[model samples]
Target: MKLKLLILLLISGYSFSQVKKPDSLQLFFDSAKFSITDAHKTQLQSFFKDIKLDEVLQIRIKGYTDFIGNHVYNNKLSKKRAKATYIFVTNNYQFKAIAQQGLGELDEEIAEATIEGGNSKHRKVDLILSYEKPKEVSVSLTRKQRYLLQLPKLSIGEKLRIQHTNFHISTPNITNASKEDLEGIIKILKAYPKLKVLIEGHVCCGDKEEYESKIINPDNLALSTERAKNIYNTLIKKGIKANRLSYKGYGFTRPLDFPENTIAIQRENRRIELKVLRK
Candidate 1:
């Protein structure tokens, strides 16, 4: 029972504090000179000292004149008075009083109240309450265009299309790919499920193979086939339907580089490519 009563008291006190309105205070104008008298100074000192956090407080420092000068001129003077008040509060009170704003002569207390001249009490600077500084929070997230490819664990029915060429093939290179590259690839794949991709694998021309010289070494073709198979297995493990994914090897037949029979050409030929067929 005692614990329940304590919790209730805490809740009630918090509610009351949150709903409390800011205190409003009025200060007489210091005339056109915009100088607060000694009496006003004492009151202001007391007000500043009493200011507390989580509470709103407002002060309207105004300027007034007898109907001696032009109405327009009086309005301008009132604005100056408000500005001066703001400066005083910010400089003297630091951030103790959040800040102050000048409403100028627009918010006249008396629409047509006149002192010496037919002037209104519109020239003033009204102080307002400010909210507390919001707390900062940290978050982790992937940026736009971030790519990740979970390899050795590709999803079933997942199809990845490369450039439109014989090199197009889904090889399980993701196993060795960095997180960034993997994510990028996965992101694209997920975006288009209906799209069908053909993965092709290739091999370098001068690779060492036992029957190369005699049997017209299909080293490139064999290497390319292996790469394609690796990718196919990965995708199958990922739960992608086997029918959705297809693999093919250009076997150095299709060269991304020169079409000649040079070692450099073979290197370029030894690459896997993906192409969208159904999409």
Candidate 2:
């Protein structure tokens, strides 16, 4: 029965991958003013009203100036503008990370033709938002795989063991056979976009002190945590939304068997489990 289930998962993982374009927004500044004006603040607020900061993987801010002043002055002005925008956003919203840069004056060719007033278009800060791409498409699934996709049916706090997912001995590296099981999980996540899960990592052994000398990291909990994190990162790379997923390591604290004297029992204890966080 386990072999059949493993085969089904392996086949289910063969889906598709995709790419998505980054989102962009712009804030125009006055000729020499770097401070964000009231109108600009309003625009920024409106632009970010619908965006979820947690879902944003990266935020890039590029500040530019018109070709009116000396290179040094223009460069400083651009940096100030970028800094002002960065401060406003960081103070208002909570995101993973942000990158800011000052490009100084725009090239003559690229800079908007100086009109009667000034190069208003060229004096601006550009904002780009990046998110993880969704990497699944419509695909046939085995009966068991279909069952796995029914995450909505499960109640919160319920745990589902990834049967075939296993890690190397005392290491975070997952075996080749376990990669299929992870892909199968990814497919299920893609199928039910609303479903959220907490990945829990477990290991087999005696007390922490007993395994401290045997393990490379010297920390049993860290090893288990790394194992869980490995799966978490794989899910992210496979296009799973980071906001919908989280992971933690339990070490050998939550073992299925007490005396793991046999290799089979130990293998059973060293496993990955997913707890339903949202359905």
Each model's lDDT: 0.47, 0.75
Sequence-dependent TM-score of model 1 = 0.33
| RMSD in Å for model 1 | 27.8
Kindly list the per-residue Cα lDDT of model 1 for residues 1-279, writing each as its tens digit: 999999999999999878745454455563465665676568668766756643443333444343334333554565566666666666676553343333223312234432222233333334444444333223222563221222212222222333212232334353333334334434445444554556666555433332122222455556667777766676566555566567776554333333336765554555555544453
Pick by lDDT: which candidate is best? 2
lDDT of 1: 0.47
Question: In model 2, which residue pairs have backbone atoms overlapping below 3 Å?
Answer: none
**Candidate 2 residue-wise lDDT at 117:** 40
Off by over 4 Å in 2: 1-139, 142-147, 208-218
